[model samples]
Target: MSGVVVDVRGLAPVQRFINRLANPDLRALADSLGAELESQTRRRIAEEKTAPDGSPWAPWSAVHAATRHAGHSLLQGDGDLLDSVTYQVSGTQIRWGSPLVYAGVMREGASQGQFGTTRRGGPIPWGDIPGREFLGLSAENEDDLVGITEDWLQELMP
Candidate 1:
């Protein structure tokens, strides 16, 4: 969602192929790519628990870890973030991300008190939170997208 932009209409190898596409076909391709990416995102949060590049997420701080309930892991509180991940296909564009307001900060992380203090004068974050990147495109993700695109193209072949 926050990565490379492909203009299939201009590229050489796929340009002619892409030109043959109706808007409906383009939309279908977008849907396939979107589904593949969303599945990767869900797996990242629910299973991998690592950055898209496969780096382990920073561990929860001791103070924060102490406050979590027994069954909860980092960012798994109430399952809201995981459930909030979604994607949409509009025209030939595939847009995907969480609509939740805090999603940006969670992905990029925030410095404690960077957003200012609460009414009680406490730090906004209450503590320094490390970034635990859950949404992104890795090499593997890009490869998967290419494969999906190839399959879509094959399906359109005469």
Candidate 2:
């Protein structure tokens, strides 16, 4: 079954950051920003116009295209606030499952010139570099998802 496997608890740092920035207005700003970003990303992703069978032109072609395009838009908005927040809060790599639904984050540095994978039980670039961001991967299972999310949250703790 498809659903949000990674619990959003790891997003506390992001929430904290936003809270600091907006202060008493934090909740309003965050709600507006989240809604805006989600709406925009969804609209951009919808432009693909997939076939009746729900197949793409090629493997990962649509996902990559949509992600790159949406990523660019997100980056260009508000001093890359969404991009930075996404990288810091979530991770830098995003992934798609089946017809739609994407996860992950884009890290700051490219190790060996590679963007890390979001796969569960896979090796990530954690603790390998300083000041680098990571993306969360949609785990293959719920347990794995929880583990990854918890790991990310711990990384943000002081």
Candidate 3:
């Protein structure tokens, strides 16, 4: 018997892996990713109070805070937004977010008069609101996804 120097589709399983990568099923992958995103988003809003980039969210203006009920926290008016955090797995995609109308405003912020004047013709928001980002993957999240993907790929291979 002679020692073989070459291998086909069996050298570390790279070929078989690559062949499957072309159009691999995304359901499992999407589910894992979406779940993590949902958890992180809710944590960002309810616990960390920081953006995915690790920056602290802008503090509420004194006037605005005064308007809120006693002991209310940022972005937790009725706990609806945080409770609404959810994820969905679509074909080759994982999208997660809140369906509430103000979700975008909270994520991206708004400037005075951005949404047009109020009924009395004053600025709608009255004051500028800085973005309080609560969605996105942090460095830790990216790393976790990499590990998850590796495990998923291994599971996919025979």
Best TM-score among the predictions, by candidate number: 1
Q: Please give the CA lDDT of all the candidate structures.
A: 0.85, 0.36, 0.87
Candidate that beats the other on lDDT, 1 or 3, i.e. the better one: 3
- Candidate 3 lDDT by residue in tens digits, 9-33: 4665776677678768788788998
Best-to-worst ranking by lDDT: 3, 1, 2
lDDT by residue (23-137, candidate 2, tens digit) is 4433333443344344333333344322223333222234433645433432232334332332111233332222211123222322421445556634454323221112222
TM-score of 1: 0.82
Once fitted onto the true fold, the runs of candidate 3 whose alpha carbons sit more than 4 angstroms away are 1-24
Could you tell me how far off, in angstroms, the CA of residue 37 lies in candidate 2 after the best superposition?
Answer: 0.4
lDDT of 2: 0.36
Candidate with the larger lDDT of 1 and 2: 1
TM-score ranking of the models:
1, 3, 2
Native RMSD of candidate 1 (Å): 11.8
Per-residue accuracy of model 1 over 1-158 as CA lDDT, tens digit each: 69998776556756555566653378888888998888999889878889988999898988888889977887788889889999999988888888999888888999999899999999999888788899899899999999998988787654
Q: Name every residue pair that clashes in candidate 1.
A: none
Task: Mark the 10 consecutive residues where model 3 has the least summed lDDT.
Answer: 7-16
